[model samples]
Target: MKKLLFFYFLLIGFYTYGQVGIGTAMPDPSAQLDVTVAAGDKGVLLPRVALINTTDQTTITNGNVESLLVYNTATQNNVTPGYYYWYNGSWRRLTALGDHPETITTLVNNTDGSYTYTSEDGTMTTFTVGGMMVDNGDGTYTFTNPDGTNVTIQGVSQALTILSYDNNTGMISYIDENSTLTQLDMSLAIDSWETLTDLKLNPDNIHLDYTDEDGVTNQIDLTTLVQNLETLTTIVANADGTFTYTDENGNATQIDISNLETLTSLALNADGKTLEYTDESGTVTTVDLSSVITNFETITTLVDNGDGTYTYTNESGNTTVIDVNNTETLTELVLSTDNSTLTYTDENGNDTIINLKTVVQANQKTTTLADGVNTTVSSTVSGDNTAWQVNVATAKGANNTQNSTLGVVKEADSNPTVNIANDGSLSVNLENTNDIKEVSGNYTVLPNDTILLGNASTADVSIVMPNPVGKKGKTITIKKQDTNEDYYINVYGNINGLSQLYTALPYSGWQLTSDGTQWKITNKF
Candidate 1:
């Protein structure tokens, strides 16, 4: 029996190691393939496949492979529940299909149903299910293990479409319900610059509290904004970070600058009027704007004349000169007393004279008398040797009347008295009446028509003698007989103190007459 068994083992080794046709004998397991094997030939030894895994093993046969490849063979679905493949001299076993779940991590979900797959070796591949493909935008996708470790799948340009990304990494992906496509968290969007809003930044923004070019203020709180402007159109932050805004009509405006010390230039157009600026020192100055302005409709120019007066001239050539604070209009003119003449010059340049005289006469005038005219007065004498003179001192004089008792001639005791009337009539009165006395001698009245008086008061004595008297002996005598003795007197005087003689008796009262109207006299002694 032993000899028979040795021979049996040898024959089985030969059949196993050598190649056999479809009709060749079956070989034992430990033998090399007796089949004709070429270099780079890949075929299965049927006994080696069955010997390594007695229940389940993969085998390769020559007639079933093309050239040197081993084609398909049935899997050991019911045998040892393991994986095996025939190669070299043995069959190798693999873990069963359910040994562990496939370690698949979903990195990106494209719009297509295709998924990108990766193995434990870090080898990457794409698998499709239900004829779907992913469009990964920018030709890339991410593959991840189940634990979220990621490997990038690039060159997906034509294969997959990207839908969203991780909020933090910005990794892109295809859309899937299971995939988290996070943008910036909506809560963190406040810090994100891409999504800013007017509602979010208006009253809360410090930059909005600002001013504009026009010196108007703008956007603060809504209450402050309304206080600044009724409404606004737009707001802009300058490069200096100062804020300014526009109105509804898009006009840039500013608020009044309360503290304007920093202003370098101010632009104001107050044409046709004076521009006044008041500084902090309470000094006011008027800006010279004549060259910059065209019309000064309400402006008034006042020029000062050093004498506390001013002159104003309008566009029309009318000028008004005013005393500084006096309200009187200049009308009346007074020429000083030193001025000799007052000349009035009219518009035609003609002068009219108005001269002042020394003194003015109203009615009376003074004049001198005409030459050769005579003035007369009636003069009378009342003493002895009375005479009348023509043109004596002060035009006329009268001497005393005749008195023969003493026979002494003297001037009139009183000044000659004359009475004259405006009608050229004259009258005379003797100023020395006591100088007349009784004549007791023969005192001849010259021219010889005389009578010596007896008592003419009791006797009517009238003497009418000759018209022509004797030249050598003109004589007269008188005798007194009432006494007891004879008394004789004679008074006669020559014409030239030698021939004429006259006498008169003593009488208490006497009278002489020559036609009572011409010459008549009476003496009482």
Candidate 2:
């Protein structure tokens, strides 16, 4: 029965400690252990803060324990290799060691009491081995390697390999010297860029290169050309933001005014005329010009009035006044004049009449006139000692005899005195024969002749008269002083002087022609 009891206890112990035993949330105090804990006052090996070596199941003092905290002991059996072991009585962190953290069933503790983890995909091998324990003070401890590499605990294993860094300087150094830098990366910088689109310009301000609607070519620089838009056809903006167009010349015009506010002025030299302008509001507003001047000849008029005034008479005898000083004011000025009576005001204001034709009459004197009596007379006519015999006779009675009828008698004087009656009848008295008996017998007296009857010695004579002469216009007149004396008078229409006449019978029996063509002797009757 004891053996049976012993087997029962064995079964009970198996139930308590074997793999089939009930697992405890806490390790048992009396369980067979791989490491022992020292009693109280084991200075640095206080069970709660010490690590025991599970491999030899030995109590490790200060020299054997790596730290005050429990460390994972992986080499010993029955010691849950990672994280913690049954020691004085608490759990501790450890390092994990496995091919992959995902497949890891165990982990190891580091000398610094930190935990390490691994990855499943060879992505991470060991998080930290013998990592430094950092008190983050936030219930988390960071692990680091002796070279100060960062540690990661993941998936119950270490799946990361960390590069070490200097905590003080942040410097990184390679554990291996076999690697080299190959290439680098870079970028680019820019200043500015812009794009201009279609723009139209003023025709008067800017010159365009284009085929205008009228098919003209206008080309100009931004500085010196006026666009005659009258000829532009179409305008286009080029890729360079310049303008181009077609003009009447069928040529292309280009304009490159980038950002100008106004185009520059240009001078034109064409013909004798010029085209100029000033710009305003993008248009040419003030346009002015000077012409190519010319000259011409002028005409002038002369006025008889030297005071620069003119008098004009029309066919109707009307007069007009005009000023000659002003050329622009001169219209048609008709002038006229008449005869020697033409008169005008002289410069001295004198009324001066110019006489070119005037008539003058000469003075004349007559000698004898017997009232109610007729007589024959003769006298000596003299001018400057040139003497001639003059016989004066008158019209006779019906008997062809002197009215006195002294009969036929003789006359002695070559010149006789004569009295003329109003009836122009005359009688003669002989110089010596005065008796009626001596004057008896029928007697006859002739004109222009002195007749002596009975004898040539008698002083009585009969004067003869010729036919009456016609009166002629004379340049000068001569008058006889004594009316009682009968004088032979000579008359001439025109005379150079008294020396130019013939001496024939003086003027007693002479007849003068009207035009002075000839002189002839006529018989006294």
Candidate 3:
């Protein structure tokens, strides 16, 4: 009995060439392993595990496993409780109907009746309605989707069928498919025709067709029109200041231009002897003035005959005499006693006096000094000579030393002490006082102000500091005199790397010094 049982098991294992079947004798030919349920409700159970994240594979203890299927039981790191399969080094959730809800982040309506849908995963999809809804005139309306699919709406009122269109009258003829034809005035829907200012035609032979007001159609040949324009009469300007126009029939008309006879320009000819002029018509006219005088002579000498008459001889040895008794000759000149007038005596012994002040006043006169720093101008008179003397003198305090001490000298110390070192450095010991300024309102500090006393008894006071640029090592002291109100010291630039300082205590003072770029608080009292 044992040998019979063993023989039956061996035969079943070898049946159908390695295909396995459970609960059934014959399995599907395509499936390597088939499990068939004979009776009660049952299904194949898959392995379930908790997945930490989509890219994690250690939860299943199979790090390099591919195509591994499992059921995720955790909801973390974008992973939900669902069936997932290992693919490309990550677990991808299997998509099924009603498995996961797809979230839409945005939905936008486009201008052309289209809708844009954006998913949570930054995926964009556009859906366009192909065209407007069209009436089919058969009690039905049709709409086209983006994919060229049509959707029909039934039970609508029937529309008319268009038969023909008249472009000239802008009328549409239609029929109801069961009634007489009717006309629709579509003039309001038609766009108005615009008049063209410039028209270009290709091949230069295109014709224009139009309908006249009398409803008569006409055609114009553009080629012929252009040829006729070329044959029209043309006017030509002649060289002799005349214009000639010829008609198509070969008849010519001439017109003489009178204004063209006027001279335009005058110049010497290239021959350097003859003068020539050009008229408006470009005609050159020459005038011969070279022969007008054969030989020219100039006066050579003049002699006074001592009888109030003179004789002159020309280069040709021709002499001429002239009476000089009528001509006045200046002999003696003298100035008036007031030095404001001058008198002149001619050869006839007659004296004529003229005011010199009037002549001097009519002309512009300017006096300039040599050097304003070391020169002095003064008027001096000696005997009958009067002149302006400009004296040059040494500048005050100019010495040979390169470095000099410049400061106010005190009464007690008539001469300030000056110390000079071998390295060309000089120092002065002088007495000076700080320039104190008192203010009760907002004030801008000046470059010369040294100490400021601000009084803020009734109201707040702000003292604006001067700019520290180019004033290196300059120091200023500001003190608040009264403590009744707020007092602010505002720096034109940064003070100790800050904009301003505030003080309200009585007699509170701040000493600020510039380090070239900005001001720094040196002392606070």
Candidate 4:
């Protein structure tokens, strides 16, 4: 009996390790469990087990048992109790019939009521939008489209016809063969890119926020940008001065043939000077270039003639005389002793008399002439002729009057007064007045005017440079009449561009010159 049991155990070993085949005595040595299912409605059965998800697959059995095959009975994986193979680290469903198909990742989008799918299998098989793929087996791939057309990429593009995208669980839903929606976990794939998290898309705004390489969260509006780019067209400049544009929708826009002719017509006339244009009514309009040629040259220099005259030199160095004087040169003048009436003698010895009255009442010496030009006479004693020093000016010096100030002249070895003629020019005809000035007051530094700060109350004062745009090249100088060298003065407004706003200590003086914009501080003493 013991010998019989040993033989039986040897037979059992042969059955377990042998190449066995059903309904065939001569089994193929290559297949261990090869089953020749004869001509009958019969099939080989596999081990049945409860369904589980990706996380629970490994927990179904322990210790990393590979190449395990089973039939899932739960149908949760959209497979009807079909065979499932465990290869690498996941549970992959297998069909009950033909050979196992490839596992792939897919991307789908809707376009014009139809759907376009892009998928890729691990075997270097790729598909584009509405594109297919075919394996050449010779290290090449052919991608095709639905109309039996191909352009390099070709393969069998499979899809599960997803139903909806779930925002809560971040999964995509697809209808299985049983008319049931099966949820699938979705992921984003970029070529050779590391895994990225914390990226979100806002469906309402159609924009996405993602952390960039610099670790900054930046948002980009992809929807509107794409829409704008789609409508954008590329414009090409033609050799004939025309342009053409082609948009993304395969539409060509052109500056028509007639427009090209119009463009050529818009050129300068045969003289290469005048601009010619043809209106829609076909009327040719030509502008004259004669005046333009003449005006191209500008006056470069305006030299002031000592006798209230100016010589304007053009670009060609040609000078033209500008006579603003209404009277002759005053070589000599007579000042009445009473300081009320004045007289003048011209160079031609012609006496053009003007009645004027001069009074030295307060710090300001007012000199009213019959020409309605009231000259405020102020003085700032400099080096020589302190008693005869005077500065005279009017607020608005119009040429509509005669030289009423001609008789108020106080000629000296060197006249210190700035004589403003009726022609809006300064001279030294020596209109002298009292050099006294009242202090502790504000004054607007007028063109060609001088402000005196001296001898009355406090020495501190203010001087302002008004906007003298139209009166360019005008000057205003401030001087201290009082011998106090420590008086304080606030000079406001950017004068002569020296200092827009500045304060001066006692005995400070400044001269501002206007250049039609702001005043520039010409001289500061």
Candidate 5:
């Protein structure tokens, strides 16, 4: 009776192909222990193991239980309390989400005409250019290159491997080490026989090459004839994150760059926040140079604070008030080997002295001597010419002045008229030509002489002007005092050896100005 009950409890009656079903007599042929649940019934129940925290998960690793499911009692970082399944290397959250899509299938022709191939990860690829092989109905395939080169492969069981390459032009495809995806419309050759890091364009030339372990480069050849490129095409920038290019036939094509992640691709945008540049592939690439490039200097304008400071904008647009304390101007500075004593030459060639030693020595003092238009001060500001005067006087002394002078005076009327020798003298008494007016007919004028031609002479009188030896830019004025006198006065001491003759009209005047070597009549009536 126990044996009969055991048989009934286990199978109920039907058993086929060593399979059993709980709710249904007929079991799935593919499953050994198939259980069919009725509607509204709970699904399969997995073993429950609660983890208080993530650290406890380490203990479960001892068992070679891959794909084992477990529930978390607490949250871990951003992960919430949920069921996680052991995956290839880590725990993956399992939710009642959509299932993975079936692998997209593809057909590829190999060197062998009669062959089939599947990628490492069963994925679909449609290559339109570079080189393509056609599968002949008779187990043979023909591969044609852009330059009209062809190759035949025997029927094989594997898929044809493909890679990307870059031509000098923008039509190219390849991924860089940085996970950058590139596409190319140019001719390229790919093979599964060798692992290729990249088929990139050389920076110095248009050739693409492969670098070996020994750092040697092998030229990668491609078909030079590109029938797709019948015309010249170039890419341009648009408001949207896409590249605009006109095909050789002049058809406009827009390439989506919205998925691109960096500012290195400025055709994408270049507003300080973004930038774009052509990479080694002859393709424009962009990286988020924002962290790399910035308006840190662009949005900034300098403002000179009325104080000795200035203000400029930092990247934040906030004003940064800073004194120019971190800069030095080397106009004509000469420093000692120890950088202790420094010398500065001003515009006027006067030097300023800085004795670093004097900073600590009471007797030694820092001295600076500069000459301003009307003043000269050292290490201090002054409106008076004291500092300049001292330098000038010291330099202009008996042996200091530009030109040395011996006490040789050019006497005028008498009274030591003009003392050429400024020996120990601080003042020069100038001859007063304002009060003296002499009546003269014709005579050569002296240095300090003032003459008035009042008498009318019958003969043509020649009046010689004074020699302008030491005089520069000095003017001489002569007036006919008598109104009734009309005399013909001839003048000399000019470049032409004859001055502009003055017709003595009453109260008329003749003025002669000297240009050091020659005298010219400036005013004549």
Candidate 6:
């Protein structure tokens, strides 16, 4: 009975835990079945299978088993001998000790028909020929599999590696994958390059074909254009702040100035007598003004105050007033009655006398006086003068004495008479003494003629008066002595606002006077 009860308790414990243990009495609580070896040198050996590919699950008899672990022994279809487990409908390889699972991130096709693989950690590995592959050197490579089967594969040309670039020749020097050096013209491969529209041009390196004055075509750089410009000899400042440059041939061109330093300030230092100028460049230049301001005070203006005073102003803006009343001014100069001294009087009524005898000596002379017939004489004597007078005595002419006389006589008179009065006056009598000028035809009036007598019996007479420009208040009379025809008196200037005057009757006359601008008829008869 006791043995049976112990066996029943054991069976209930097994049912309650539902665990299986091998070679041990206690099983782990986390696992359904636990296998353990107590003291043996044995290990669990998993089942081994040949997997054609990771995705082919039909190779395993229990292909649907998701977590089935196995050791793959196949080397075909990229499957190697490794431990793998069934996961998500594929056989996934397990990493060995000290190994990391790397995924291929990139693949590059090489020019030599090989492929380069880049792993996720940036490790690059090249896939050249396979392990069993050999190059035949005749555009083909042979691959030998483990089954002893040989296969020939076509080989591509070796890829080229760029070693250097020659910009001047537009060529590239490179070495091929076979270690052979070669050069390629970049100009021939220009179509493979991208067009650059914003390339910076270097003036010194760029060349151009230029035709010179001698008709020679020469290769020059862009900088040559600036070097060939006309050289300037002189620069002049213009009023508009521009500069005019004159070349050697006297041709001038104006250039606008920019970014030039400007004068910031100009000041004068009175103590140092210097003019300091500062520019925008923070440079200061000093000019000595000692020569220009040599004098401390320079009188600029002087005003005479009419009241015997004057006001003067200096360069320093100071004014000074001066009185000239006390200054002596000459008023009069007199000579003494004896002619021995001269006296000068000033404005202040002061006199200064000078002795004339010391300067010059007086000269005196005397002569005897005599009287002629019928004359009485008197003589007086002075210091520097001798006076002598002779008085004639009145005498009556002889009662019967007659004096011969000369006189002028007219052509119609036999003789002319002249009389001498007792008062020493003479008188002569002539037939016709009137100043008369007779004109027969055209005659211009003379400046000194007082009367013009015209006889129009043969032809009409025309008398022209003198110009009245300078002859102001002068008079001339024109008379028609005969009445056979009318006589005309003409004046070059206006005569009483008329140019001429006419007289028809005998003894008719007109007297004209010059009123400066024109002649006026003052009298008509």
TM-score to true structure, per model: 0.17, 0.10, 0.21, 0.19, 0.20, 0.19
Candidate 5's TM-score: 0.20
Candidate that would win on TM-score = 3
Task: Give the top-scoring candidate (lDDT).
Answer: 3
Question: lDDT by residue for model 4 over 113-167, one digit each (tens)?
Answer: 3323333533222323222346677655664433444545223353435567543
* True lDDT of residue 422, candidate 2: 64
lDDT of 3 by residue, 238-275 (tens): 66655554434345566554432222444445564454
**Candidate 5 segments whose C-alpha is farther than 4 A from its true place:** 1-414, 418-425, 432-435, 457-460, 495-500
Q: Write the per-residue lDDT of candidate 1 for residues 101-152, one digit (tens) a residue.
A: 8643333334475444333444444433332223357676655432334556
How far is 447's C-alpha from truth in model 1 (Å)? 10
For model 4, how big is the CA root-mean-square deviation?
34.7
**Candidate 5 or 6, higher TM-score?**
5
Worst ten-residue run, lDDT, model 6? 290-299
lDDT of 2 by residue, 116-213 (tens): 33223322223332233464555445655434355543333322243343323323233323342211110000001111222345476655455454
Identify the runs in model 3 with alpha carbons over 4 angstroms from their true place: 1-381, 384-388, 391-433, 485-492
Q: Write the per-residue lDDT of candidate 6 for residues 219-262, one digit (tens) a residue.
A: 65667675443232444456665655443434455555342222
Q: Model 2 residue 74 lDDT?
A: 52
**lDDT of model 2, residue 168:** 30
User: How does model 3 fare in lDDT?
Assistant: 0.61
Better of 1 and 3 by TM-score: 3
